[model samples]
Target: MAAVEIAPTVNPVTKAKKPSFQIEWASSSSEVKEAQRLRYKVFAEEMGANLSQNAEGLDIDEFDAYCDHLLIRDQDTLKVVGTYRVLPPHKAQEIGRLYSDAEFDLSRLDHLRPKLVELGRSCVHQDYRSGAVIMALWSGLAQYMQKNGYEIMLGCASIPMADGGHFAASLYNSLNSDQMAPTEFHAFPRLPLPLDKLNGGLEVDAPPLIKGYLKLGAKICSSPAWDPDFNTADLLTMLRLSDINPRYAKHFLGL
Candidate 1:
């Protein structure tokens, strides 16, 4: 297969000349469709998001049209290895819904100032799950956030599991609930799980992504909520840009 060719585009914010690995802001209709295609491959086909035909193997919704899409293309293969969607707080509030709202309540956050940004649909092709790909995606996001003056980053971090088993014990262990709970915590009672059938115990450490967020001083809000689409309960996490650990700031943003 011929490598997918991506033309280099200047970063609107920095204006610094850098040869990104086909990093571009998706603007055209075809680019959006391609993003949907990649989403289908990862979310529906690979992750089993239980989406209907309307989802078309694509994990998209009404918000996609209004949000900005970040795509990372493999230079040699020209394939989209990683992708994420960023929704500005203004747009999110106008839309009155977030990707996690289906799983958790978000109305309580209406009072927070400085606005917010919701990060979602974060997925990388299975074959290209590496530090470099993730780092590139974050680098692009950091630049975009810095340019826009975003104050906080919020999103749900999924804990992977085959069945409906939840894996947020470590998060509960790490951050606990009282110190920093989500303003809109889940009020519903915990769903039952067959603890005996699960592999070993479920109380393992946090996943890399969750740990990464915590290391960045992100606080876990409330308990886990069941996400049928992904077949895993997710814990909502929030990271204030000012609170991010200095170590990651240097490593990820080159500060």
Candidate 2:
């Protein structure tokens, strides 16, 4: 996309242009830094995830160099309000693994590596948590996939463990067989959530991002992994391009 200003995302309900924001790929190191700064703000400062303290206040890791940064900015202020990092298959191979590989044994997904793209560190600024920002992110993602011919989207979707994981345990316990990936695609968590120790019968609603993934045909790959640093239960999520919901196909993929 060459740092191009993409088409204004339309509000599905209102059919009005969201002129307050612009979405684009990070074409420069400074642009990527902006996205990283937002990640630090959301993950470290707001959510209190145990990220290493940095002088520049950026959330960074070894994988950042191998991934492409996607940014959604406030047009008025030019602040990156929403961000997602994408690891293409080639880059993942160069990096030797997808980030999810650290948390889960993804041996079963070996056959699909050539077709997989990893999405991670997804976050929207607290003030922009309204529906539109997320939708705009999706629009940018779908366009990326459509142009690149990627087949699968993979990532770890986190569930807060504020209640010591009862909600995550219950949510995993509540999935139907159909909502789970086939056994051949199942990933085993290295540090699994202690489902047996938690109350798994609580009625819990999935976080909005997770619910949206499920609606768009993402499947749970296996049991949740307990991410101590993030203080959340991480579900390895897989979404096949072929399985995208028809309703979202048009809005996201422009099919």
Candidate 3:
């Protein structure tokens, strides 16, 4: 069978010549649609993931209506290089739940939900996956959290399971001891990854996004969940504002 040739992402971002990228909330529905299109390109076209709710090359979902869409756009090309959908507490209440609730049981986190924000559908254009672009995204997130007085953030960090889940299993086991959250905050996955059946000895570095969260003192609050549609193992990660690594917190929050 012939392999799918993924489209090359345009206009790569670099540290030396970083493009003028502006991060802001989506001001219009069109902007939100653009972010969704970028997501489809990466999560669907590039990775070959099956998106059941995807429509017209956009990763559409009910949560989108209730969430704030943050976009990082390249001023040179006027293209959206990165995006994150943030569900604030009130909006989560309006929607009656968060997107993460579908993949994992978050009942243990009810107490934190009042001051918590749920981050979902986070992605950066493949070409713009540089330190500058990602940092810009995080800087926006930090500002949003502080501006809104959010105490905690939660999201699912994904690891590709195309290797038949071995790497995901190994990565989970490797980080469990040091990065795992307390039992009181533990979540249960709806479709848990079968770790026992997979090899957990392979030494593989976590993906950059996951690693960044860990560097910021994010905790893995549950075992891996098998997301068949996305073909990845999802780890529930939580980060409290007070728990951020002091060294990097200033950089992200501009403190």
Candidate 4:
């Protein structure tokens, strides 16, 4: 009888591990590059932001070198999926001004600079839009500010103007008086969105991201600035640790 032909025993193929996420501060140039590349992907390619990107596909600027980058990575894949660059008061001073200063007159914020941090270039990988990534990023930000004794945060929250600015115009118009920052804290837009000329009556809601900020006690600091390069109407938003909504403060800061 011919010897029975037997196949070698096969080992089961293992599947990739997933669903693990971790927050970290970028500690090196290479790590910062990873965050910048993700920003390029989301801002330039996905959102059509006219960014002055390097050939390395990184959304870099003068501020990047002076900022601390908070990154959220899929631990299983070791991929940087979300990032927010933060410029602390000292760094913002070193950089001459916050990034938002180009579009808005931030003189009103000068008095708060000693305890302020400017957050910018916030973006997440398209695959990680389930709210978890952003929350994780915000958690990291809260911890960062707490650790450093920073009391205030400010940034430009961008609203899409794909409808030739109507949605942004309408959203600005729709905000009640209380939703705005106190007059003393308000920044003036250098190139304001033409709210008067645009249709400001569309039945619209604030974008989810802005809504999230508002929920966390972020106040819109001024009229929206028209960003030609990104085609966004940007609202300068400010958040003070003391101002965080009680419900969210408990969740985000245990206060």
TM-score of each: 0.78, 0.94, 0.90, 0.91
* Model 2 lDDT per residue over 1-255, tens place: 744354555767876663776888998899889999999999989888999988999999999999988899887888899999999999999989999999999999999999989999999999999777888888888888889999899999999888899999999999999789999999999999988899999998889999999999999998999999999999999999888999998878777
Assess candidate 1 and give its lDDT: 0.68
Clashing pairs in 3: none
Clashing pairs in 1: 4-77, 4-78, 40-57, 182-221
Which ten residues in a row are the worst by lDDT in model 2?
Answer: 2-11
| lDDT tens digits, residue span 1-255, model 3 | 111111224555633443378777887899899999999999999988897654478988788999889888887788988999999999999989988898999899988999999998999999989877777788788888998899999999999888999999999988856699999999999999999999989999989999999999999999999999899999999999899999988877665
Rank the models by lDDT, top first: 2, 3, 4, 1
Note the clash tally of each candidate: 4, 0, 0, 0
Candidate 3's TM-score: 0.90
Candidate with the larger lDDT of 1 and 2: 2
lDDT at 193, model 2: 90
lDDT of 3: 0.87
Candidate 4 ranges beyond 4 A from true positions: 1-19
Error of 4 at 86 (Å): 0.1
Evaluated with lDDT, which candidate comes out highest? 2
Task: Single out the weakest 10-residue window by summed lDDT for candidate 3.
Answer: 1-10
lDDT of 2: 0.90
